[model samples]
Target: NVAVILAGGVGSRAGFSRPKQLVKLGGLPVVAHTIKRFQSHPLIDEICIVSTADHLEEIERLASSLKAHKVKKVLGGGTERRDSSLAAIAAYEHEALSGPLYLIFHDAVRPLVSDEVIDRVINALRHYNAVDVAIPCADTVVSIDQVTNEIISIPDRRSLRLGQTPQAFLHDTISTAYAAALRDPPRAHTDDCGVVLHYLPSEKICVVEGDTYNHKLTYPTDLLILEKFLQSNGGRRKVADTGDRQLTQLRGKSIAIFGGTSGIGEKMAELGERFGAKVSIGSRRNGVDISHAPSVQEFLKEVVATHGKLDAVVNSAAVLTYQPLEALSDEDIVSSVGTNYLGALHVARAAYPYLRESRGHLLFFASSSYTFGRAHYSVYTSSKAAIVNLTQALADEWDGADVKVNCVNPDRTATPMRTRAFGHEPQDQLLDAQTVALDALSVLVGETTGCIFDVERR
Candidate 1:
């Protein structure tokens, strides 16, 4: 499949000197980031960025600056979006694109778009001839007259969808649709899917649930929110260590161990390495700033690039609480949730591509206290409970994807965090961290998800 990026529009709303797509989100140009994602996709065969004739020089410079090598051609866009799309179609035909070509059209302004979404669009296009990525309207939608303030129609919000790019199509189907549009053009629409809907039947148009995080950058104020998002979700390139050893049993497979440098995570890495699977480890000590979403995102991309495939993931990293609720600051809660709950979510999202590719297993480290309800461990327990709930929800949602999601609830593991929570206790009641690690690994090694393994040596 070949991907085409629409970078023609001058985003006047963003108030930049040029198009908003060229604006920087983090360090790279927003369009550059979008292009890199498709470039990184294993299934995508080629990439072409369609920009304005005036912007072609700048876009070429931007691509070179970002080291975007997968982009085979950089062409000029048309007067309108339809024209811009036709320009891309012409470019594909010029190349004599052979075989069953799948075409994906993306908005360059949406920098946060994930590889998972791109894969979904590709998978959809393979089976169905045409599809669009969209989010169902969340708020009550009303259509009002431009002349009068009165409501013209109360549209069913459930049926209404906020269209987004990368809208995908069979190359021939879209080419046909565009050619037909040129004969008797309809009113201008933002997406090619809208153009197709005019000429094609309703059954031909399909909508895939779009991630709300895949937002388009349109305003200056959005930068701050995006920055915060980048920070919390893990940045542009965060590294994960996939323990891949040639002599290991699962040598060809890939497994991820969160906080693998220490505690149960370290033990899991050892086992995974011995099992012959590539293990991806996330550690704060390794310069991974999960507090920043962009950093986390970057780390995940690094892990995927390193392993080339991901077969399993076990989040053995977590924070323990010591302060009372009254004494705890917002910083404390942020640190705990950022590492224990949200950090896991970020890793999961980042590792999604590998899991989808491998149809692998996902394991979370929860706590018995989360379910048993212990005192003075409010924040820690709360975070674990969130993981448990998330594991359940993700498992339910991943029914179509064939990936397994589950968690391990350990009662008391003697790790550094446990020492911080209990203060140098020489108690035999605590279970060995390695023991918990093996139990979690067993669940992943097998095929089980949405189940929490309670490990308490009582």
Candidate 2:
């Protein structure tokens, strides 16, 4: 893969003394920062900078000052943006270059393209054969006649996506598109995607959601906003001294599911194990009893001793009641609440210290009835609701300690409890317990720390 940065733009509109690409942002030249970003990427074989004839030498000097690697300078200054872009494309097609490679065309003015976004675009191009990064247009737009300057019609912005770069393409796909454009270029076309869509089939173009901060530095005022964004996100976007582009990999991350024998708990364990996590499956048959407090505590201790650390704990084991309000005696309420609500609390509390050590996550399972009160399940619903509040309170206390507490309120899942509540059916397409558990697992692994996720997996 190769990254082509179009740094040949003249900042006439911005009225800056220097080219916009050379404008200092966050104490570094904007194009220098942009090249530095991709220079370290493992997938990016080389980084080529297309600068105007006047600024080529200065751009190379700026790169040298930054100690940027994997950079090659190309002399280019065109009357139009498309011409400069084509020059970069030509450098990508040189006889010395590799054939059928993935090429990413990015604007040097947009210096906020993080390593994560670059990796994502590369991954998409590898998978889909062609892809473009874009953000959905958030404003209403009107189409006007060019001659009369009169509004013709209001276009639906909901279906419109504002294109951003690095627009990824196959070496052949982009090479062919630009070759055709040079032969008979369209007067109204602006971006590379426009050329591709005009010449290539519609199915050839694919869109990926782009970051909102990835805006082109078109005007003078925009540079100030870009600088501010860089200052705020400097810690996250700054290139490492080693120039390694690999972000934090999820290897050796141990996620132990307490009560991972069946239902949602079992599904979560399977996923944890699948994602290269050291999964410790706990079940009564395996001598990890969920009913008795002492036995449960001892089992948890064993897990902690074995793993030496825990990354996440998902407590999906719960007891349910199906009796009507009148038929639900105090014993029924006590049994249901003690096992479902108290069991969650016990597991979370027992794992709190271990979780704090690793900044682990604690996930609880609640029923959708906790939100929508249903008939004949008052005791179960109330018990689950208590778990929700427990999660909130625990999250509040553990906020500063780096421990996350969250709950999943699943609806009508195809589990043993669902059969007890809704009874047997010929063919009821209820939510898949595994799907719900996996979705909740993803949430637990993500940055959404404290919240109740109402999941319905159909």
Candidate 3:
């Protein structure tokens, strides 16, 4: 199976100086994320990108940086969307003669296309010649007369669906449809599925279910919406279960842990050492205040000087004060934000150079409350939310440089910080700090990046 990414649009409607596909989302270009979806999927055997002539070189560079080894070709596309689709189909024309071949055509702007959506399209193609992905439309559709500014008819919403991408087809089926189109093209044709439906009436095009998050980047505001989606797990969520498994990948790796004096950080330091990692702990109690930028920079510099190369940096440093907004002073707000939010930022920025050189990982900590704000712990919750976003953003930004950035969102853990904020919780209700630390260690040694590993009590 082959995945063809259409990235030829100029994106005038998106209001971007460059094409919308080139716009940065999370850290890599929009098209990079789109390619990554198919690049990482197990079913996809090869990839081909159809891009504008002007951006062809840049797109090739991105594919190389992503190590998209599956990409077979990067061809120049015509002006229209169908033209790009045709280019992709034509590229595989000769290859189709060898045997049966399948092509999955997807939009480069829809980066959040899930594995489920791709799986459905592939499964449908097994029984059908052509397949399309779409979600049921919620809004009522109106057919309006062009002459008069009046609605002609209202269609039932249940019958309408908003179309999405990864439209799959057998190589011969799509090629035949396009061959007919070139001789007598339809006056108004949008997608390859439309051509197949029109040019070959007997051929049935199957419809597969797409997701709400598989939306195309059409307007400027859509970028912000996509960013929020990316921060919220990027449509891929995983539950970390270390389960007494020892991660030997940490052997000989140099790891730095902030807020390592107690709680999850301390436990992480202990486990890292147990796994043969050269561990270094930093905390305010140890004369290193993460909230202070210079303190973090100096500490990392020392770690590098001692170990020669830093493999992973974990910032579990956080401050949780459960005071209501009305009673909280300026100092209290600053303290919470500085430590929980800014401290993560400081660590990420300071650790980047080292991590990039070593192609290492950077991990941050987030609480379960990051999904929503909690009463009396508003500042703490908000800061954790920021950490989650920062982790995702840096994941994108540092992707090309080979630095992995991720966040660990653990449920209420029996840590000193939690104890200080909320007094005497039930022992069973809180997670063990060691358990959370183990999960963090697993992520640090793993290849997955730009994700939030949820650690919940079983």
Candidate 3, 102-201: lDDT as tens digits = 9999999999998889999999988999999999998888999999979999998998999999899999999998888889845588888898999989
Cα RMSD, each candidate: 12.1, 12.5, 5.0
lDDT of 1 by residue, 1-458 (tens): 77888888888767888788877775657787687667667878888899988889988887776566778889887767877788878877744455677778888887667666887887787578898998878999888998889899998887888888789887778888878777884677667887788877553877787887678787888776665454222122112223332333466777767689988889888877776677777777887755556766776678778977677777777888877777888988888888888888887887677788889888887876775456777888888878877886787578468789887777677888888778876668777877776666667765545556666675
Reference-based TM-score of each model: 0.60, 0.51, 0.73
lDDT of each: 0.75, 0.73, 0.89
Candidate 2: where are CA atoms >4 Å away? 94-98, 146-149, 234-458
Off by over 4 Å in 1: 94-97, 232-262, 273-419, 422-458
- By lDDT rank, best first, the candidates go 3, 1, 2
Give model 2's TM-score versus the native structure: 0.51
Residue 437 CA error for candidate 1 (Å)? 6.6
Kindly indicate the candidate among 1 and 3 with the higher lDDT: 3
* Two-way TM-score contest, 2 vs 3, winner: 3
Whole-model alpha-carbon lDDT for candidate 1: 0.75
The model with the greater TM-score, 1 or 3, is 3
**Tens digits of per-residue lDDT for model 2, 181-245:** 77884567777778788877653677877887786888888987886555333223211122222
What clash count goes with each model? 37, 0, 2
